[model samples]
Target: MNRCYKILRTVALTPSIGPSSIKIVGAQYFARAAIAAGEFNSTRDYASPFDADGHGSHTASTAAGNHGIPVMANNFNYGYASGMAPGAQISVYKALYPFRGYMSDVVAAVDQAVEDGVDVLSLSIGPASVPSGPSAFLNVLELELLFATKAGVLVVQAAGNGGPSSSSILSFSPWITSVAASITDRRYNNSIRFGDGQSLIGTGLAPPTIGGVFFQVAAAADVCQRNITAGLVESCQDADPFIRSLVRGKLIICTYTFDFESEAATIATVADTISKIGAAGFILTMDPDIGYEQIKGATVTLQVPRVILNNMESSSALWEYYNSNTMRSRSGIDIGFRATTRILDGREATYTWSAPVVASYSSRGPDVNNALLETADVLKPTIMAPGSSIWAAWSSNSEGDQYIKEQNFALLSGTSMATPHIAGIAALIKQKHPDWSPAAITSAMMTTANFSATPGVPILAQQKNKLSPTTPFDFGAGSVNPSKAIDPGLIFDTYFKHYVQFLCIVPDVDDMSMRRAVGVGCPSKKTDWCSDLNTASVTVSNLVGSRKVTRRVTNVGELDEKYIVLVREPFGVNITVRPQVFKISVNASRHVTLFLVATQTANSYTFGEMVFEGNNNHVVRVPIAVYVSSTLGF
Candidate 1:
């Protein structure tokens, strides 16, 4: 805890009614553990600011961790570690307890954060499922976030780690900046070299020095007890004492059945058994359905060398060698393997085409909450950030429990890791532009984000390691570029009233509940509820021919700047802007009408974008998505 405090001076450890003037405030533990232990928590506890789970520490450090601290994971050094905004102070709010969190506690924490005058709120937590209709009001956290934005605080949230699945984003409130997880350019590659000169690449986070001389190889089934069940033995699940003698000096080969329930446990059991029996090494084989993309394994300190073979062909070759006559005649087959790794240290290399892709676990979105609203189908995951295999500060108390070792730093992956990166960037933006509204700050970040890190190469998804084109639903306005975000020329701005109008338009949202959420009543003229929403991105679904939408933008750059409108029309759709070019004075605002006309009847969704390019090199880009209905008429 002291080490973390060194990174920032204003870190609040406990909730206090200290001077309201204080800029940063932290509440250690807002939620108490449930009476019964579940997957995320081990026991019940009281409210405190301390992080016993290590997640809070990791996220806090990622946001504003101290600069120039050497970090390592699984015995591999990753050089110095620093947060996205190392100079920014952080207020730690510990709303998450162990693995579980109570909505009441989360709401209380947000109240305290707002009262303490925090400029930015970073929440790496959310509801477990999609929020829509009346259930949306039940989201106390988001309701509090609405109040926080009203109080001039920018809230950044995790997009949830449920991805490769459409409509998986849970944080759908347009008032909050939802973040998705993306891969960094750096990756840890662990390879295995066989005696026959056959080599295969895989993923692991153990020490790179776990390779050497060849050892005898034996299948886990061959070494299991005679009385053991065929199913259990074939899966290599249990590490019984009887099988220890057989695998004592050989490399154990284990196969995964791809059973989601038992796959993880099976791998752990095999690794534990190998360590106990003093095996030279272990080789993990994937099911045919698992695919060839190497899955990042857990970070562990292993006594023996271990490598995974994600390719079916490689696993087949090894199996064939193990079952060969030469190996049957002997006690076990001789095998050669080496596990080595290289660290990129955060340098951008064009030769590497695998990174900056959407992580398979990072959530996708179409903003399910907006499905019920006629005009307000908002896009989610305001932006993407590097979240996979991130190294950050870990709680010393949680060492060896949640973390692999008793160290102040650890490597982790999730949207939880991505949220703080945006939060830190938000902090910088807030510091630079203190008067900017939360929506303006979000607009700046969204409009200025880069679609792809490398020119001409579309951002890819990590699932198949392919360069397939992704949608705004996959990555909203693209990945965040902090440098560009700091100076977005024109920002799409909104206020609490706009969001309240948005909620009023929600099909089933009650007026009383909406009043409680925004502390206001629905206006008498609510006809233009959705059209009144001013955001950076535009989405229009079920369009037959022509549809018009209005967008208001405020010039935050130089006075009397002219921005030429550039439109990339979606397939089967022609977008025309009235008054093709516009000029705005400093701090002045302008509204533009966009006419989206379908050139031909279409049955699918199409995507395009509009770029407002200024002569001074300041560009404000807005993504446009249109879905044409196959039906001819309404």
Candidate 2:
């Protein structure tokens, strides 16, 4: 059996025997059958028929191997050392051809993993952006996954590193468990320092003004006297030479040329050039969309130790500063460039800092459910986990390859890291209860899952930035708690039959009110598809009101024991559980009536926990909701 949350620490109980317990059906990756048959190297070439790369190797290690080490790239691996289910056996069957694109690969992989007897399939890769349903990949790759659910196999996919919004259609699918990114380390970066407190908000060089002088190189005397203005002629001015001269300390005012998103690279190039030429600082101007002679560069600040100026407005501000002293402060602002980590000596450079939160360029989602969100049905990420600066096993062995160590690993981030955690967790649950079906496993997770690390605290909506009670959206059903998941109080127990029912049945207000009884969505005005009770349950019970209600329930277990039933009020509804006692055992059952009198202002009253113990001890809670006045109002 797979050791829960211990994939990389040690060899599994029967490492030599391998994971013969789990079976892969559809995809070759999940089947590792070829390896069992002495067909391939389980770790090095998991994605066979396609040349090997390092990514798949690390993933396989955490999913099955017993050892690992860290490595860095433009990225790094970030998350727990071992995956959620270390004991679960894994095999990578190559479906999509290498570099041919993911369009056909995803479908073939899923189909074969199921065929290979894979009880659980985990996919760490996804499209770069939220996919539109109209896209070919969506129609082909994603649609095939919809069929995987019917096959009784659990499918998990990465939510995509692109934040908040990545849980949508192209990248996220309802059939797959979407994963999100979170931070493990609280400390992100060291403070940035700049030399000479006096900073400039540099402007960009435009056509005619490209010749304007801004600063003199402290080291180059003759070059300082050189009237670089002559070099500003339309025929002579090119971005390269102009940027080069500026680096040499002939403070060249220039116009901003690419997207602000590339500011980090742009500044790095200019700063490196200047440092090489003995220049102290730069006055990078932001003269976007203007002519040379007609426009003056705007100012922005560089966080580097270099004395950089920020160009907020026009060069007129600099002229005003140089020409006058009585001015307290001109309208100047600081503009910063976005930066990425620079790895030196196998670690991030000290001057370089890890980004707090996620990169702004990283897209966010589920805010306004588009195609991706619709496919996900808003069941996503479930929760965020460490996805940045990650190090994982790799495959390549070429001399000059980035991933070549016998214990090859590389750093990476994105939903890729997040998906493995869930996959591991699913494996653990399967390990513990081998007889449980996929729906039972998923239901146990969704219902019993804790929804928040900080309970009762509100997290603002990503897009709106508005503070509201966090739901499945912010921290889906609370973050994934493996320990808690192992023993969920009440499992939802849904099946594909329910999915078919959802497709065919139309629920009435009774069904509508029943849905509102649970905490999925608002009450429907009339019968609507949103009120589908097929995939979920229709809770019905009278447990509302501030007044305490008491009742009794018999224990139904193999042996005798004591049972206690309690209730905690939902929002706006005040409630208290009156003490009750019931004792029974061996094929017998009991019932409890929790009396509740909801306050007039209490809009909706929900249910709480019903504790059980003794010979048959299994903690469980039932969901019950009471609407205010019962007069339908949306």
Candidate 3:
């Protein structure tokens, strides 16, 4: 076993959780026994649930780690970190290793977690692609989650990393609350001031050059005596070419190009090359031909001071400044390098209000009906949360990101990061309402999410190079709102039978296939279809003329309240709700009927919403998305 397991086992055996300064991981005194579901590395090393890869520790701490723990890295203190639900207990179920994982092991972990009576399950992993089966919902992992949900465990999964593309979602089942990634209000920005007094904002997470001293800058090509072939030296990938005398104590400039993206060169390699050559720091300027630049993952961790000018304009301006200040000899060989710059501290965080935008890498919707790219009526990415640049607990020996191998914490991004936010919040909800079903908890969160950025303005999504208005396909109910969700006055509750019925009416799935998948046949009489699954949102991929929908709500609050229904119709459809206003007593249920009528055929899907304003300070929102093909049957 690894040294981390030895430490974890020692900590686990201790009866007391101790104090904040004790440096507790996710599992503490409240944790049960850690279990490994299968053998990995061809060894019976399955007994210990030690998180050597760091993903488990990162996700677990993101969900329910101890509160007010200081996040220290590289001799700098970022700040205090806390999980969404700090008081909740945690149990490790090791299923994946650093290199690879198998579905059989994941299934076993799910079965074991459910059997252990865990109230909430957070999965930051998913299939490489949509599962190949009769239906994506019929896959073994999805069915295991279905059974877990039936047993009252709320399951949350990552929507996948594929995004900004249509039908790129990996989590397509309705029972699972798939989460999408979004940018938070926090941002880290660094700047470098040239000797000419001009400054350029860039990305890095390291301290400023020591003592406010401006370091002499040199280009990798000029300092290296070797002939520049294919311009590989410009990226500082080779240490053999550099002359230690010219490079020592100088800030070196490197080029970031398509080569970096193709894995031919990497930031880790650049950092290693600069460190070995005794350079004070480095700057990575984008090659204009690389088009859009993306610097993420472990590259964020920098031991040496550095700046990555990631845009064309910034990179071009820097190059112009460098060339003007630099002096080359007549033979274009030995010359006086006069360029100088100073890097500023970048570990500090800056807060802004313009965020919660859907990340460019978060998977998008129009949940697929099967593996064939067919559309389903259900909305994908049940909700969005802060996923970009999230800092949480990490194992020092983690192999997930080599650049950050020895660090105890990592700032990462993905739908994987967003999922634990919901899972932790769900733990909070479950603590408050022990009797609520998984669907009720899901409905509470969905119906109370903030669909708009501000008043009358929709939350936007990052579409490749720009931001655009979004729909239910982008973020199901919108970004999650923890404050409004806990006291969601009414919730749309679902049961195991509802999911079975959902499969029964799937366009291409017959009762025989459904039975073969779930081992349960559909009911003899069925009045519901795919779109009428009683979720918090309404979606119709193809709407001809009109459709009638009914929703049932249960008031869980203490007092009786009256609610008024308001509608914002979609572009090509008119929506009407019956009795526009109604009152209900505590614990009472009400049925709301909605009728949608198409006025004209729309070339694309349009978005709208139905809101319920309660006298008791409760607002319930239901999103509507539809593609109108015709106003009448032709």
Candidate 4:
């Protein structure tokens, strides 16, 4: 299901309005220039015409620009949030429109960005999957993205909120950049409370024949009331025991429903009904289903003591009891119910903005549709960034809603939240290498990426236990390392023409229909093979052509900087960098590069360093694998 739930959140773009919102534009010519030129500009002037969401500003500054804050962007100007590039300029473009023409406008804006000389374009929006039509709306976007590669623009798009599964498809443009959002170990404090109101309370004592128990039935819309009010009252299927357990005048346990009613109306109804019925508090169960809003119709009145069951903890018990045939037959002392005026406070729970792994909501890769899959089989999103509970500029026009008063800052999640980080980094890279191609930039960042685990921490699920490192489904190519990307010794560069050639080699793709899907002809593999296409080809060339790219560091203790580098084509690869000594000058820096030759497979390698000693104080290892064509059977 294209739904968001289970700690997974989406980064949705707010409706474009004033300062609090995002405005999008078209980029019809952007991608083309990026591929051709391999270089662009990233100016950092806050006073530009596009002063949209501060999200871009924050991400830009952290990844590349020179913003001077420590908390939000981490003071590096290109610090914590400083993307792969630490010294790039920034160009702000506000081309997004309201919900109505969002896609068309945004795509056009991307084209425009290329025309305006933007080397990288980042988008935080996504399309809904409607199956009854073309493969999916995103598939169409993929075709348009081809124009970007032709234009030499590197497009970074966010993975959708539909996640925890591989069903979701990232935008399938060969040259369009795709990114997924990851949670960090950061948190924020917030709370929701129930209001007070009159309530009906039911009281009943358990009989010796049955287990000890007390029952209550006080509050708005109890079971009996719902049946009778509906007139054609059936015996409230599967609800008799729940009802009989409650006493006539005491506290009664009942389910709450207010999703359909306005917040104000629901509150008013609860107050009036509670006063008339006379009841105590209530106990509510956490929802098990997933969605943008998992808890629905949960009405808690402050007038009564409300008890909440952590569904994660109580689900097992509820399931066991619910399945018992004699649950309702258990005898108990019959105690009359009662009505009363009482109040209770709501429970408080604060959620963290960052946690390990991708939010259970960000979409996955392996774009279906043979015709569309050919361009880039690269797993999405291309990388991960902070998209959970990120604080950014909020629209000023949203103050009218009772639940939300207009504020300068707002918290959001989703690929929308991560895109700005990459865009900012693009600017930084531009600042350093004004003539670098989008491919060169992306390749540098991806190749230099590391997959080392943190010290004193065991990989865990729910903060406990450890799993094997092969869990690619959860940690794609491991976590992203921006610092390493800037200086990646080896790169896995991809070009638009090469990606298109892969599509033609697919056994099931309909060549005639491919044109309709991507607006391009499939290259012929026979005689006039596309292997010679004028695209940037990535092959397993010798690091130094037998020269062996090597370096020496002599300022440290006599330690074996013993290292191992291997390429696993598209399947598995490993890279290790070990220092043989432990002694070094306090104010000196050391550097080295591990190289992995690329094979004919469209894959990349990861790096890490296993601790030879028990002290756990060594840098992690990494692997260098570049994506290559398997047509020649590498």
Which number leads on lDDT?
3
Off by over 4 Å in 1: 1-25, 32-47, 74-76, 134-139, 208-211, 234-237, 259-268, 292-303, 329-355, 369-376, 399-405, 462-467, 508-513, 527-531, 599-601, 630-634
**How would you encode candidate 3's per-residue C-alpha lDDT over 446-479 as one tens digit per residue?**
9999988888898999898899998877888999
lDDT of 4: 0.38
Residue 519, candidate 2: C-alpha displacement in angstroms: 33
The per-residue C-alpha lDDT of model 4 at residue 536 equals 17
Report every candidate's CA lDDT: 0.69, 0.39, 0.79, 0.38
Best by TM-score: 3
Cα error of candidate 1 at position 536, Å: 0.7
Question: lDDT tens string, model 2, 1-634?
Answer: 1101111111111111134556221123322333333434535444443325445554555455442333322233323355445555665655322222333434555666655566666666655444333232224455566556666667766555444443342244444555555433332221111122222332221111122222332211122224444323111222333334434434333223443334323444444444455444433443434323211112111222222223345334433443332222244311211111111111222223322233211234342233322332234444444554455555445222321333345444545555566666777787776665566666556545443344454333333232234434443433456776676533445455444333222222134432332223332342223223321111222222333322223232235666565554544454445445555564454434444454454332232333333334555433333433432222
Clashes of each: 4, 99, 0, 119
Candidate 2 regions exceeding 4 Å error are 1-80, 95-104, 125-143, 160-175, 186-188, 191-384, 394-410, 458-469, 506-634
Mark the 10 consecutive residues where model 3 has the least summed lDDT: 6-15
The C-alpha stretches of model 4 lying farther than 4 A from their native spots are 1-99, 130-140, 189-355, 371-377, 399-405, 450-452, 455-475, 496-564, 567-634
Q: lDDT by residue for model 1 over 1-634, one digit each (tens)?
A: 0001111111222121122444234454454323222323334333456666677778877887767877855455667888876766667766555345556556666788788777777788777665456556435666778888898888888888888777788778889899998878665555666556556665555443233555666777667676776556555556663367667767677766655243355455666667777776677776676654534444433434666666788777767666652333254433322322221112111235554888888888777644454323677778999897788887676632432446677777888888888988887787778889989999999999988657776777655455467788888999899999999999999998888877776666667876666667888777443534788998775576667788898999866688899999988887899767877899998898888777766654678999999978888899887777532433
What root-mean-square deviation over C-alphas does model 3 reach?
4.9
TM-score to true structure, per model: 0.86, 0.53, 0.92, 0.52
